[model samples]
Target: MFAGSNRLTIDDKGRLAIPARLRAQLADEYGKELAVTLGPECIEIYPAPVFRTMAQQIPKIADRAKRVLVQRLFLGNAVESEIDGQGRIGVPPLLRDMKALGTDVVLVGAYDHFELWSYAQWQANNTEGQTHYADAFAALAVP
Candidate 1:
């Protein structure tokens, strides 16, 4: 169970050292291979099997418009990465720029996958999401 959030720093070369607790979870579930992909507001890191399963679920369609949408959303931006001996994974330049990530970042565990966010960006996003979903969330929690 990956839980809590950790503030992380990206080295000049874009390598992020996974938190020790998260590393233990990855090691147990994924061995050493993981996949990193762009998310709506951040980046998602997943165990290889989980990533592959998600990729496979992208709908197959012969129509050009649907194909383009799926391709751009799922295939165009995906990146595969592996955790090194020191439990660090490098973020690609494009992804870093997309999320406005700098030396400081926050890694948030999302059950099956993890999300990487710039500290400021995460704060803004979290606030917006909470406000946007507050009503729905409260209803879901009814006893």
Candidate 2:
């Protein structure tokens, strides 16, 4: 049920604090365990339980090659992590470097998980739907 966005920062030590509004939901429902990995255009964070469920799907992909590729890209790069008492989570150096995310950031609540995007990257990809809205809504069959 996670939904919405927050502007945040990764401190020099590379920790980002979850907003207080979402902190309790995460702590109470998900516990401290977490998994982080690089996603298509941003870094992804998932509760350990949720991540485990996704990991299990890797072996079920019908295509052998695609399954293997996904395993390596998703599972291979995942880093186990947790939220600290101060409510901050450590962003793995690898994922941070890969996503160029050492500064201001955008934390987007994706139904079951969260996405961390570099501020610049977010701005670049979040252009107003001036050009793509029609195709996008059409694809989703929205009226």
Model 1 residue 140 lDDT?
A: 81
TM-score of 1: 0.86
Q: Which sections of candidate 1 miss by over 4 Å?
A: 60-67, 139-143
Q: Give the alpha carbon lDDT tens digit for every residue of 1-143 in model 2.
A: 68998989999998999998788888788888889887877999999999999999889999999998888888888988887889898887888988899779999999999999998888777775447867776787556
Counting clashing residue pairs in each candidate, in order, gives: 0, 0
Q: How do all models score by TM-score? A: 0.86, 0.89
lDDT (C-alpha, whole model) for all candidates: 0.83, 0.88
Q: Which lDDT value does model 1 have at 50?
A: 88
